[model samples]
Target: MREPRIGIFGGTFNPVHIGHVRAAIEVAEALGLAGVEFAPAARPPHKSGDPLLDFALRLDLCRAAVSGIPGFSVNPLENERPGPSYTCDLLADLARTRPGEQFCFIMGMGDLLCLAAWKNGLGLGRLAHLAVHARQGQELEAFGRFLDHNAKAMGAAPTADPAVWSLPQGRLMQYVPVARLDVSASDIRRRWQEGKRIDGLMRPSVLDKLLTHADALPAGWGRPPAA
Candidate 1:
């Protein structure tokens, strides 16, 4: 039997933006993934302060953001679970549901650096192959060092470590070229508060919900500051 070509894109998605969606699509296409699942962390252990939106609302926005996108869907794995969510735990759950499936864990360069600090970091290599998106101006050599430093203790396959996982011919991180976007979730939330139009930034469904719950969002939601 053929292995399932699955991609996992996880994030806080304070307010899902076009950039986030674009990144997922670009990676999925490049990897020839059969499907991509966007998992909004229920309560990110790494986030210092409280989430801007309630767990239910965050999940709703995530679902709306990828509603029409083909092969893209939101999973409630993290949100449904109690307590702070960990990537390792989430991957374990996925492995149980889809036995023998080959999974690809999609994340950014920054995430790879923090992998060693995550729970069950060593076991992750057994769950999925790592596919990290390169950050702008970030050298692959530096990333490779990070992997080597962390994996040496855990015994994770050095070759599978995204930091060192480069194509022989290219001598580059197996990267999927994508258009970089400057849009940030914080910026998006800020714009909504400043009464700026968010036509192209967020999905209509997500925008509607944000507008519906304007009062619950951060300080300036849907209202401009006094000039």
Candidate 2:
């Protein structure tokens, strides 16, 4: 039997935005994934000093964002797990619970560029294939070179195609092009703080929840008075 393919999309998701939902939808359709799991991180190891909203609220927002979306679900694995969240650890947990399943770790081009700096970065390929979303202004040639370097390091044969690269332990990495959206969670927050319109940037449910509790936002989230 063919192993079920599941896409693991992990992020802070301080507030799930339309950009996020759109990317996941596009990637899942492009890869023919069985399902896409939006895993919200309780505490990201790489980010610091930025006050994240409560984890429960973030999880609720994630659930709301994916509501009524077919083949999409939210996973609170990272939120329930102790300590800072790491991709490798999440993959390990999934491997244990969902044996004989294939996982594709979905990420953006920027994260791919910095993968080597991640915890147990080299082992990432062994855990799951990488489904990287292409970003604007990024050189494909440079990306190919980086993948070739990593493949060689893993004792895998290099390929002429940059879109797909084979890795040791039968892992594969593929670049997936998705619709570009100028939306981001931080931008949404900033807009809300400035009392500017953010109607279409986020899902209606999430935007409504945030607006309903604007006063409860974390410290430093409000806009400063005009000079």
Candidate 3:
């Protein structure tokens, strides 16, 4: 029997939207995972796009978003650990703490493409498996080329299945395909700020909490200040 495995999905979850939740669901289903832990970043190294809410609030939103969802839970490990949260570090810690369970670090193909730039990216397989998901219209060929070029670098070889690659530390990197959910946190925040209906973009519970704290949102989200 295969060793029981769980998945770790790390992100700002800047108010975990439906897209984020749905993608995680797809990856979990595809990989037959025991559960997926949504770990919100306490301090991100990048993100010049938009200002974020307090880590506490973001963590609250993530918990609220996944609340009552089967096989999904929030992990606050990043919050406990000071300094910028990196994937390799998080997975390494998980590997140390959870000796009996295997872990799959979940991420998007875009992130996979930028792995080399991430802190300790290449060494991730030593820590845990990587389940990278991609949306339609993405360049799978590029990913294929990436797998081909890095096969030696990762000390991995192709399996009978083209999409799965072996990694040095008894880990695997597989490409998962998920439906294109045209939803994004930036778009959701912009909609909320623009005074538009964002009813269906996220879980209703999440919307409720966001509205409950609507006044707390940054003005830069596009909401004009009161005159």
Candidate 4:
């Protein structure tokens, strides 16, 4: 039997916009993944905000965004937890809980560039295969060289380790290009703040909810709800 392929794409899902959905869908297809889970970070270590919508509301927005999508679901592991969401911790739990399944931690090239700085970065090579998406012209050579330089110093790793070291000594990595989109949650928030139309910027369902619940969000974010 073939191993179940799972891709974990975690983020704040601040508004669960269309760009995020596109990326998830594209990566899942590119990697031939059985399913892709969007894990919203409960409290992202790298970000500070009013959380515009409370946790439950944010989760609800996420659920609404992917309502009819196939092979896509939200994993609340990070959302339910209180502290900062660390990728290593999440991967480890996934490895143990789903022993037989093959897991890939999906990320953008920007994140890959800073992977070495993440907690337990070296151990990540052993936790799950790293799947990164890049834009058409984004150079990945630096990342490749970084991995090549550290594969050995990192010691024996996991998941296709043998193949990893076969590449240049400092380039132990695999990359796949996925569709790129201009939509960003930050931009969405900014547009909302300016009272700009967000049509076609997010999933229809999510947009509706955002419009309906605009009253519940923090002041100065997006458009204010009708008086």
Put the candidates in TM-score order, highest first. Answer: 3, 2, 4, 1
- How many residue pairs clash in all the candidates, one count each? 0, 0, 0, 8
Misplaced by over 4 Å in model 1 are 135-138, 154-175, 193-195, 219-227
User: Tens-digit lDDT track for model 3 on 88-190?
Assistant: 7888788788787899999888788888888988778778888888885565677688878776666768888877888876788888888999998878777
Judged by lDDT against the true structure, how good is candidate 1?
0.72
lDDT of 2 by residue, 8-43 (tens): 999998788998899998889988899999999888
Every candidate's lDDT: 0.72, 0.81, 0.83, 0.71
Clashing pairs in 1: none
Best model per TM-score: 3
Cα lDDT tens digits, model 4, 1-227, are: 75767888877777888877887788788778898888877767777665455667777788888889998887877765557788888888887777777777787777866777878866675777667677645555654666666667555332453223332222223566656688888787877666678899888898888778766765525444454
Ranking by lDDT: 3, 2, 1, 4
The TM-scores of all predictions, comma-separated, are 0.81, 0.90, 0.92, 0.82
Q: Pick the candidate with the highest lDDT.
A: 3
Model 2 spans with C-alpha error above 4 angstroms = 136-139, 154-156, 220-227
User: What is the Å distance of residue 145 in model 3 from its true position?
Assistant: 1.5
